[model samples]
Target chain A: MTGTLFLQTLVDGLILGGIFSLSAVGFSLIFGVLGVVNLSHGIFVLLGAYLGLALKEAWGIDPLMAIPLVFGALFVLGGLVQITLVSGAVRRGSLMSSLLITFGVSLMLRDLIILVFGPDVQSLSSSWLFDTFRIGGVIVDGARASGLIASLLSLGLLSYVLYRSKVGRAMRATAQQDFAAGLCGIDVKKIYAMTFGVSAGFAGVSGIIVGLINPFTPFDDTHWTLNAFVTVVLGGVGSPVGALLGGLMLGGISTFSSQYVGSLYPNVFIFGALLLMLIVRPNGLLGNAYKGSV
Target chain B: MNKQISRRTALGLLGATMTSATALRAMPARAATDGVIRFGGSLGMSGRYAETGLNIRHGYETAIKYINEEKGGVQIAGKTYSLELGIVDDASDPARATTLIQRQVDEGVDFFLGSYGSNVVLPCAGITEAAGKVTVQVGGSADQIFTQGYENIFGFFPRASRAWVTSIEFFKSIEPKPKTVSVMATNSAFSKLNAQAAAAGCKEIGLEVLDVLELPEQVTDSSSALATLRARTPDILITTTVDQNSLVIARQMIATETNVPLLYQFLGPQLPAYRESLGAKADGVVMQLPWDESLEFTDPTFGDTQSYIDYYNATNDRPFSYHTVGASSCITTYIEAMKAAGSVDPLAVRDALDAIDIVTAFGPVNFTEDGDGDPILMGAKIGQVQGGEIKVVYPENLRTAETLYPTPTWAEKG
Candidate 1:
């Protein structure tokens, strides 16, 4: 391939990588703190997009301007869901039950969104952001570029919260050893709820970015969810940084394969790479000593 | 042509027939009068294709609305009544559609209009047909539906499988014939069937098949598909995609900077999303379709499309899609058949559907028996998407505009 085309693929891949990374980090966060896989994470993202769309269409609010509203709404929704359903699952310590409940919630959420938004693919006029920014004869759309920036910013903020904040410390303590952390005055249950809420909020925030980049339908939730899983596994299960790197890597591989091999075989390449990664580096690059251990 | 059964009484008869399947064949023939014939439609309400489904629904409703306003409704024997139409959201689910069809049938509807996808239509039509209700498929073109030999079912949309060979014919008729072509499709039953059929037809025409790519059904992105195209770098890329997926695929092809022309069989650039997403990239994308708005058809209803477009704009605040074109065709075709039969008898409507030459806003449309003993319609217009317009360019008599983009050099180069 020519240098120009290769560069073009890389740039596009990075933008996509940014999206995958954003989606994966949120999933890993919930998995890390609560030990509950948020299967409905993709639905939260879709919900956020739809909320933004509804706000835009109904109240004439710009999608970008309505981002906070969308994020807040989903955050509250996630909190309610966590208190009612997820907390119960975490309390029981049944991972399989958590998976089933979350999957059920995901399907219900998908159906509800369909009922509310209708089954049409909706998109905003992204011409404001979809414009080509040229770099060395290769053009990358600004929407994707903006999404990448937003993803990085979100990740950075998440890192600060996890490392520096009071809730962050409790979350880490609870995740490492819940009984010990409970004895040390950290409310393990509360940490789980807050962590899940934050995780779900991230999902919503990233969903808005996704909507800005591409048209979205309710059914697309599953695909986004699946990609996030692959990213988390690839980056390092239960590790936020690992999820980020994994997302970017998977995105790069998939986009490159689509550009060079065949768009048709990108999934095969992605899963194949995941298989190789699993075999060679089970903990992933920059992953924790324990990945699926917890 | 003038049967003695009235449309309202036909509904009553249908209700009686559905009450017991055994009563379906023995419905009493009542005296016919042209009344406001109500036909109920169940289609993809909200799903991946809600936009296309809604457009098709608008087309049918518009045709019905116009016929009622202008022609005073379909004439039977001597009297005339306006047409009343009702549509329900099936959401493209078969089980939900079965319930909707049953509910509509129980409500004493005269005829039933089916949806755009086979997975939705096959079971829905079976329910309506089992009730001995005349059903017309508007959006869906599954070959099996027609081949099963159900007497109550009639199809308005051209079969998807047949369009490929017609597209090949159109390609051959072009001045500079395209030699090397690549095919790609999402591995859905509908898309795969179309892609495989088109590739086979291309090979039969002695055109070199450079590559064929099949992707998973839920391909969110198209980077890998674009790379494969760049690798083979064929002259034209033939793809069978529906809704945003196709638009995404097109955008990826453009984003990747591969300028190979595209030949799409299922969806055309008549969709606003297709043009909006691809912009300048859409130029030279050839779409095979059966209808175009610019055609100077003698049918007075042809002019009604503009009014329908206005209606859709007024209702949805957007222009009508190509799907609306098919939708309107379905409604008009059904009305004409009902007019010919002069009664809502399911078997009579079926025979009328077979016999009538439907002069639609789109073009002359009617079905003929195919090799599998199924009713399949033939013909498609070759339109090139250029400067955001899907301009019709083939079939000299029906040509609406000149080819938008010249056949790109990529179509002939090694």
Candidate 2:
């Protein structure tokens, strides 16, 4: 391939990677802090997109302006679900139970979205976002560039909240040892709810970006969830920076294969790479060695 | 009587009386001549195919309502029988669709309506055929359904194997005369067959087949695919996939600015939701339409095309598409067959369906021996989105608007 084409592919991959990284970060955060595999994470992403779309349609608010409202709505919903249903599963101390609970929640959310949206594909339209710009003979989509920027900003904010805040310290402590942290005067329950809320909030932001970038349907949740799961596992289950790296790797490989190898079998190359990663380093590039946490 | 009779004699007397009463009760409550003709089927009401499923259901419902309320039910054997339709939600799963068909069969439905999409319809066809019931449906255009030699299953839509022939012919007629084509399809039964046909059809017409990409059905992103298209830069890009996949491909093509002169998709571009979602981006995209509101055809049972559209639009919250028209035409076909055969017997109706030839809102309704609509006699029209409205642009007689040749690139479009 020509240098320009290669560079164009790389640029596209990076933009796509930004969205993938944001999607994975939320799933990773919940797994890290709550030790729960939130199966409904993808639905939360979709819900976020739909909420943004709804707000735009109902009140003529710009999608960018509706992000905070989407985030706030999802945060409250995540907190409530964590407290009401997920908490019991977590308290039971069975990873399987938590997985099943989240799976059920995912199914319910999927059906509810279908009920409301009627399973047809919907997209967010911004006139400015549809414009294209050129850089050194490589074309770049305005919406995707914006998505990349939003994804980076959201990830940066999440990193700050996780590393530099008192709540972050308490949340980390709770993740390491919930009972010990509770005894040490950390409100473990509140930390758990906060972690879910933050994870879902991240998902909300990712959703808006995704909706702006591509058309989505209620059935798209499973595919998005699978993509996010692959990203998180490849990057390391608990590391945001690792997720970014993993996302970039996945995006690059996928785009490169489709452009050069063949469009039909890109997934074969992508999952093959993930399989190789798993065999060589099961804990992922940045993840610590696995230990039985639950 | 109690004092005089022995226990055995009294028991025998009561048994005889009860047996007679039971026999009388077991007889038909209403005369056989006054019975209702029940048509049963399942639809994908709550899954990936829900959009098409709902449209099919609405079509059948509207047809049945029209027959009952307007035509005063289907006349059979010198008697008017009220048409009763029993539909179940299959949730877009073939196995569930089969189970629902079985349940409907067990309920003793006289006939069956086919489900939406080829995957669901194929299995449901097996059940209906095994039960010896006549099934007429507008969905499931895959060639396999016809190749199976299922005498009981009749499809109203043109075969998937021939679905793209009209589109290719239209492409050939363009002023610029496109030379190369790229075909992409989701890796599903119906889509694969359609894409294969499209490629073959293009090749037969002396156009170079640039590439054929068989993508997985669960693909949520099409950026990589668009990247490939941008590189190949075929004159025309054709995507034969389900609604969601096609929508994603259309959006990504625009987002990545893959500049093909002409774009066509299987089912997505034809949908009202496509225009609503993509706005001006949906313009210039071409598709094969089984029915459009502009058609001036009329069925004896459903009156004119406009009448069906009016009734359908008045009853349904969403605007009706060709799927609705096709499905309603299936019901119209059944009504015509029953009226011709003068019997509600499945075998008779199946025979009548095989022999009956008529035009409806969708188009001509004539079935070949394989139970597919005869392509030469009845088929889809090629349509393009002109000014946000789907206008029939092929078959000179039905052309509502002229073809906008060499569609503008994303950058060029207003």
DockQ of each: 0.38, 0.52
Put down candidate 2 lDDT per residue, A1-294, tens digits, no spaces.
488788988998898888899988888878887888888899999998998889988998888889899999999999988998899888887889988999888898888887777776788877676788888768888888998898888888877877798997887777777889999999989989988998888898889988987777787788778888888778887667877887888788878887778767778988998898889998776764232221
TM-score against native, each model: 0.79, 0.93
lDDT tens per residue, model 1, B1-414: 235467767888998878876554323211222455777868786766677777778777777766765555667546665666788888777778888888988888867777878778888877777777877666677676766767677666556666565678766666556778888788788888888888888889888998888776765676656655666776667888776767666654544455664456357466776676555656677887666667644444545555555555664543576667667766777767767888656677777877767556666666755211122233666887755677777765667667533345321321
Q: Write the per-residue lDDT of candidate 1 for residues A145-208, one digit (tens) a residue.
A: 7778888888888888877888888888887888999999988777777777787788888888
Q: Which window of 10 residues has the lowest lDDT sum in candidate 1 chain B?
A: B25-34
User: Who wins the TM-score comparison?
Assistant: 2
lDDT values of the candidates? 0.72, 0.83
**Candidate 2 lDDT over residue span B1-414, tens digit each:** 676678878889999999989878644332333668888999888777888888888888888888777766666788877777798899889999998899888878869988888889998898889899989988788888999889988988768887666787787888778899999988788888888898999999998998888677766567767766777888888888888788778777777778789898878888877888778877899988877788788777768888888888887786677888888888888888988988888999999999989999887889999999887667778899988999999977789999887888777777
The global Cα lDDT (0 to 1) of model 1 is 0.72
Residue A144's lDDT within candidate 1 is 73
In model 2, the runs with Cα more than 4 Å from the true position are A289-294, B1-33
